[model samples]
Target chain A: MYVYNDFDETFVRTRVAQFRGQVERRIDGSLTEDEFKPLRLMNGLYLQLHAYMLRVAVPYGTLNPAQMRQLAMIADRWDKGYGHFTTRQNIQYNWPKLGDVPDMLEALADVGMHAIQTSGNTIRNVTADHFAGAAADEIEDPRAIAELLRQWSTDHPEFQFLPRKFKIAVTGAAADRAVTRAHDIGLVVVRNDAGEVGYQVIVGGGLGRTPMVGKVLRDFVSKADLLPYVEAIVSVYNLLGRRDNKYKARIKITLHENGIETIRDLVEDRFNAIRAGFGGYDQTLLAEIEKSFAPPAFVTKATDGYEAARLANPAFRSWTDTNLSAHKAAGYAIVSISIKKHGATPGDATSDQMRVMAELADRYGHGELRISHEQNVILPHVHQSDLPAVYAALRKADLATANIGLASDIIACPGMDYCALATARSIPIAQQIATRFDELKIEHDVGPLKIKISGCINACGHHHVGHIGILGLDRAGVENYQITLGGDGSEMTTIGERAGPGFSADDIVPAIERLVTGYLDLRRDPSETFLQTYRRLGLAPFKTLLYPSEDKADAA
Target chain B: MPPRFTPKVVTANALLDGDAVWLTEDDHWSPLMSRAELITDEAHADLRLLQAKARASEIAGAYLADARLGADGPEPVHFREAFRTRGPSNYPHGKQVETPPQT
Candidate 1:
């Protein structure tokens, strides 16, 4: 909900003009494909399988009503009338033309948005918990720092071109909704014993060909030293990161090659040198940024009425039970609008639905929306008094799905349908799974389960972190799927281990059903969740159901 | 027989006015003979037609000649060269080049 200042406005406008010139040069042959590739990537323009795709950044997944309306307008005017919200909290238009990308950038700039660094080997969008400011258990609002990092990293000359793309995530809540541990750099804001706020900085964690949990470089870095510390870390990676091969170019690989102790010492040495030069500039900037993100004043209203309404309407009660989270303010709750409608594509919202969300955010909640890392929208602050009205509006828009963390609320990437690099279809697989689970009426019985699917090894779907992860691949011109179990994408993050042999695309869904049924039967109590049972028993029991012959031989 | 490579034509969304067209053959883009003449088919008839057009003597001559223009002016010169050369401001055939009067 932060408005662009004159400086911000001028910067984006100038960037758009520069890119337009670059595009013109590319079209006229002044720039070759090799030269133009990096330039286009810097602007978030990608040449996918069939057409060009443009990805626009929604910083820290926060958007005002006006911004959401602008996105709707862009989708209708420029794209195929629908925008795909990504797991990274960005929106991608899959069918943009190459020549019109400059115009698209200009349109975004007009709305105080840009696609800069949304792609390419630079520091990408800084993500945070969707319910950052509104979460009741948050030690501090993560977006304040996230926004500061956004400004500092934007067009940073020194780190603009890295060996590979970098991602950073921050979370202030203990529950770790931001998936902090799975990022190139993760920062968890924590208050120490003296009530002084600092960040617990974690480094070297990422999901891709290699998956490793970030190691803690600093247990506590003071609030003022955050920017300098980050700069030092990035500088170390920039200088020492592998450039010989694209596959091993990430900071994770660098950390792996060089011991963590060595990297930590180098980062600390760099931080000490830069910390003195920072001289409270970040503190002043944070104060100004915090003013823009200040929580709205809430009236002390009676929530007994809301309780009565919930008791009267069973549907409302179910929705409130599943979708609502405790708010920091009394008599308020943070609501997550589920986009996972059964049998529909995941992470896609029609323009009309977007407008409806924009209207609701402006009228009922604080005129703000946050797109979650799970591809859902969060109306961060809504008063208890207005729950009934908001619920009714959402129902009218068909945005009132009661499933939040249930089986049907799956996170999937735009796989073979849109991505050129994808090996098989992910959206249809997620859709079929959701539909099958809905038909079975066993979703609620399955309890909290995260089913993440990636079309390839890119791990864009965060498949490595799902409780039941499905990875799509191509085998001898036929589509095959691999399943992994015991994954967790939370404060306690762990990469799932692959189970037995890969299943053919036809055999995947049945295999998943078999595993779920196995969990149901093997569980000591119905209270045991899928992940709990998987972790307690390991992959052996699930493998028995999935690969019965292999299990028997192993048992022998 | 393998399909031939033909340029695919595309129009700017802003300039299309819902009447523009392009030809795509073998991943290459080229200007169509006429926006109205170009048509889509359920069975990839347009792609076949584009491949045939790329092999036509007249189209091949124009494509080679356009390459001589050296990255400026009309691209993949064909009947649509007039539009690309003169700009859509002077559509339906006009002088290819004109200089403004000295200020």
Candidate 2:
């Protein structure tokens, strides 16, 4: 909910105007596709397989009611009647016309949002935990730091032409919902032994064709030194990162080739050189940004009505049990409205659905909303007394799926369906899996599973971190899916290991069903989740479940 | 011995709308793959692709895709090209919106 100031507003308007001229020039044949391609990508426009895709950044995954409503309006007026909320907490309009994109961007700027830095080699949108301000275990709200980074990274001259696209994530809480370890740079707000609040700086983690858990660059850097410290890291990466091959261009490969100690030494040298120049200016800006994120006033309310509703409605109870999270404020709950309804495309919300969520946020959620990296809409500060009302509105809108961490709640990329880079269709696979699981009615019983799918090895879907990861590939001109097990994107980040041969598109759903249903029997108890069980037993059991024919041969 | 030439068609996303379009026998960009000029010869396929790429103002990322001759027109031989011919399976958008019968 960081409101744009005069400078921010003017900057966005200037960029939009610039892009409009560029689009016109491209159409008029003044600028060739080669010249215009990079310019359009910088503005977050890409010509995909079927249409132009515009990725609009939702900075820190935060939106006010007005901004949410404007997004709905934009979706309805232009392109399709819905938008896909990506794993990066940004929204993508898949079918935008090239001529109308300028207008769409202008509309976005009207609500202090833009698609700037959502694509290309420039620093992408800085993401944070969706439950930043509201989580019970949070030490501090990470949005202020995230906002500071956003301002610093947006159009930063020196870092714009880095070797590869860089991603940064910050999390305030002890829990790692932001997938901090899988980003190029991850900052966890922590208190040192001296009781000074600072950040645990992690560098070089990424999850594309080559996945790596970030290395700890610094134990702690005081809040005042964060800007210079991060700048030093990027400055080091900018010079030393691989440029010869695009595949080896990310900072991860740099760290891998040069080792973290060497990178750390260089970063420290750079940090020392630049530390004095900062002059606490970034701290002053952070203080100003913090003012916009002040928590809303909480009202003490009776929970008798909430308790009564729970008793009266089993569906409401079920939803509250799964979709609600513990809020920092007393008598408040963080409501995660599942956008992944059974058989529907994951992360897609229609204009009507968006409006419904906006209205509900206004009525019961303090006019604030959040888009989770898991692709769900969150009402961050709903009072327990208003839970019933929120639930009712969500149910009416078909947003009450009551499946947040269950088997059916899958994360899937646009895949070959829309992406030019995709080798196989991911959305259809996600849909079939969810629909099949729903039909079996074992999602809740299967318990706390994260199934993530990516179209290719780019790992935009974060398939590397799912408990059950499905990667779609083109094996001899046919769609093939490879399954991986034991991946966890938590405090203990682990990359999933592939389980033998791939499954055909027709065989994949049943294959997944066998693996998940097999968990019910393999687990010590229902209390032990999928990740815990997989850890305890290893891939041997799950591998057997995934490839039963091999298990039968072994038995024979 | 050279590999057998696969039948192919020139395809690209339209510059204005970004919808998938194929170069027809008349050298016009048609949204329908059926109207595309199928090239059986490898040299002709490469030449047609180059011609399509030259029309940069009208299209972007023009390339040749594998296809086969059908009763009405050319049919996509690969699933990727087949998806491009209609639209995404998730929704009735894109070419599916234009031609509802196929959807």
Candidate 3:
């Protein structure tokens, strides 16, 4: 993990001090709500439907054991004994009191974390693949670039307040685990024909009311020129992005209005103008950041014990099969602790759960942790030999529900339950669907399905990119849900298309069940996953199944 | 023809704690929905909204919520306001967790 230096520490402390004074002024009748709203948002404080929410950035989804423990302490001390990990690899405290937020910020700063740029119309936290350093197919750890972007954009005067909130994601692997294509800017680390590693820059991709797959602005840009290149992109957006309408303000809309070629030309011109200003400073910084991400040493370990445990315990076997991923290091595995336990709040972890994860990271994962964009915690480098021990510890904590990439591994936003912007509730729908699927005992059989739900078109839960997407809406004070099929957020990113009319909240789960059961019969074989089958056979079959005619409905 | 006026209440999140509170007949914030001042006149609703907004130091994002007097007290007519009254259904937190049963 990247440790904060003197400058970083001082910078965070200064921000906290500034926030403390701002809080005091607001409470003492010096600052009005209007005056304090933007200030509070800049520091990651949000007044939601019920309470104040404080979002803390987990840079590139990476954390050390100490930082994780502090997060647990903060949850227990200030929040309601739990925190919600978001799809952006950030942790949110939904119940922090406004008066106690300054203290929370201070505590976060103590452990080399801060809530800066976690909200507002500023460059937000730069996210990377959760399996960055540990993935077997990685070109390079993308966190080096992610950290550079974080430092450059934290309080960058040039891009402090853009036309809209901008998001950036980087992935080192060929398989896109970071949902790179759904971000405002997506950087895929790819090697050029010359066999030199560089970024395949995709610009204008975003998921909100309007969903778009990013256009390839530049096929490849060398690592040395990455910062200046990105700065140029943001600069172009800052100039050309619409200011007249808040809904049409994002760079995606800008890119849509003015073609990618024109935007590319402007970006190149701006790149040349400010490219000299970077002065090779970021290259030097990148080298230092790369050193901090050096892989831990691996020792030869026996796997017989792991095999024995798998044979002895069926639950452990099932968990390992679903939750373990291939690691770059020999005899090591990337363990995904499914925070999305069946039928509960997705991405919610209690203080005790957080502590157990911190301890497991310390004992078996080299004191390191990574939060996936899927809302699960990752022990990035666990030795295969220690799988039994990790599994046992996790089971004791109720953290061992093994539903990664399955039907029950659902991604849901806070929805109307907590969000002021939500039109319909999303959490209960997700819980009911997961619980219903578990009761059917068909989750494992369904296999490799991503069910993502968003409260509204904001797409915070990434509903637009799920294989089975459920979008919650409000129609005449009643909850209505719309389903979409064939969306894939992988190397081949495609927005899922809506399947006809919406389903009421009550009828949604059964409707989903019908869709999935119909899909099982629609597939060529069980080997073909949901996405594979949907891609192979178009939405015609699924559409008919979802909204079957009176004749077809009676036949069933 | 003019649109009929609906009963309303001035609601806002308390600045210090960020919990939902409503303006009362006595010009104070009460966390309970039943204690909220029910406004049937449009002019009075606007006046109460302005009065609630004036207390900026004590509250944030004050606005009129659509509600009506039920058999008990002020009950939310819209689902959004109903959620605010009882809190989120996913968990027993906020007003639902700490508040006593409705009279």
Candidate 4:
């Protein structure tokens, strides 16, 4: 993890003090609510449905044990006893008071974290693959570039108030774990014909009211020129992106209105005009940042204990099968501790759970933890020989759920429960589905399905990219859910297609059950996943499963 | 034809705590939605909302939410308003901590 230098430390503390003054002004009526709204949003404070929510950025989803412990302290002191890890790989406190936010931010700054740029129209926290450094297939750690972007974008004067909120994601592996194509700008580290590593810049991809897969703006931008090239794209977007309507303000719409070719030419022109001024400073900063992310020394430990534990304990074996990922180092594995326990709210971690995770990170994970965009905690450097001990500790804390890519490992936004913009409650729906599938004892059978739920069209849950997407909406003043099928957020990104009409909140779980159970019958074999089956058979069979009555009528 | 106005309550999030609060008949903000003054007339509802909005230091995002005059007090007519009255569905926090949801 990147430790804050004196400049970074002072910068964050100054902002916290400034925000404290602003809070006081707002309370004393010196600043009107309208005036303070934008300021509060800039600091990642928002008055939601029932309470104020504070979103703190975990830059590139990286955290040390100290930072994680501080987050637990903030949750226990200023807000509720738990925090909601969002799909953006940030944590949100759902019950923060208006007066307590400054204090919460102060605590965050003490640990080299902040709520800055987590909200508002500025470039939000730059997300990267959760397993960036540890993944076996990775060419290079993406978080180094991500941290560089975080430094560049934080309060960048030229791009602070863009047409709308912009998001960027980076991934080093070919697997695209960060959902790269679903962001405003996506960077994939690739090797060129000359075997030189550079970024494949993707532009204009976004999910929301209008979901679009990003187009390749440039095939390869060298490490020396990545900053200038990214700046050129954002600068072009700053001028040309639509601001007349909030719905159409994103660069995706801009790319749609003006052709990508035109945008590409403009970006190239801007890149050339400003490329000289960069003068290799970014590369120097990147080189410095890369030093902090160097992989930990691997211990040459015996794996006999790990193999024995797996043989002795079926539960531990199942967990290892699902929650562990291949690590770059031979003796190590990336452990994804599922925050999504059966029937629990997805992405919520109690203060105690946070502390336990911090302790685990300290003891077993080289003092490193990662918050995946899928809303799970990653012990990114756990050795296989220590897996049994880690699993034992996790089990004691109820963190050892063996459901990483299963139906129950859902990604859900805090719908009407906490969000002011939500149309319906997403938490209960996610809970019910996970609980139902767990009760049926078929989550493992369902296998490798991504069920993402968003309370509204904003797609905060990335429902647009789920294998089975559930979008909650208010239809005639009642909660209704719409289903989308065959969406995949991977190297081959595809936007989900909506099935016909909506289902009532009561019917949605059964509808999903019918669809998944139906999928079991339709798949060619066990190896054929939900997404593959949906792709092969298309929407007709799934539509029938979702609306059995319509199928019956058609047959009749 | 003009649509009939629904009975409404002036509701907003309290400025300090940021929890849902409603304007009572005594003009004091109460966290309990049951104590809210339900305005049957559209003109009165609009006026109450305007007055609620004016208390900038006390509240934020004040608006008229649909409600009904129940036997005991005002009850939220929409699910969203009902959720505001009692906290989130997933946890028994917020108003639910003080007074558990009645069925």
Can you tell me the CAPRI class of model 4?
Answer: high
Q: For every candidate, what is the interface RMSD in angstroms? A: 14.8, 0.7, 0.8, 0.7
Candidate 3 lDDT by residue in tens digits, A326-350: 9998889999999888789999999
Worst 10 residues of 2 chain B by lDDT: B94-103
Model 4 CA lDDT for position A446: 78
Model 3 has a clash total of 0
Proportion of native contacts present in model 4: 0.91
TM-score of each: 0.85, 0.98, 0.98, 0.99
Candidate 1 lDDT by residue in tens digits, A219-251: 999888899999999999999999999999999
The lDDT leader among the candidates is: 4
| DockQ in order | 0.03, 0.88, 0.87, 0.86
Please tell me which model should have the higher DockQ, number 2 or number 4. Answer: 2
What is the per-residue lDDT of model 4 for residues A303-397, given as tens digits with 9 covering 90 to 100? 99999999999999999999999999998999999999999999999999999999999999999999999999999999999999999999999
Chain A TM-score, cand. 3:
0.98
Range of the 10 consecutive residues with the lowest summed lDDT in candidate 3 chain A: A545-554
TM match of model 4 to true structure: 0.99
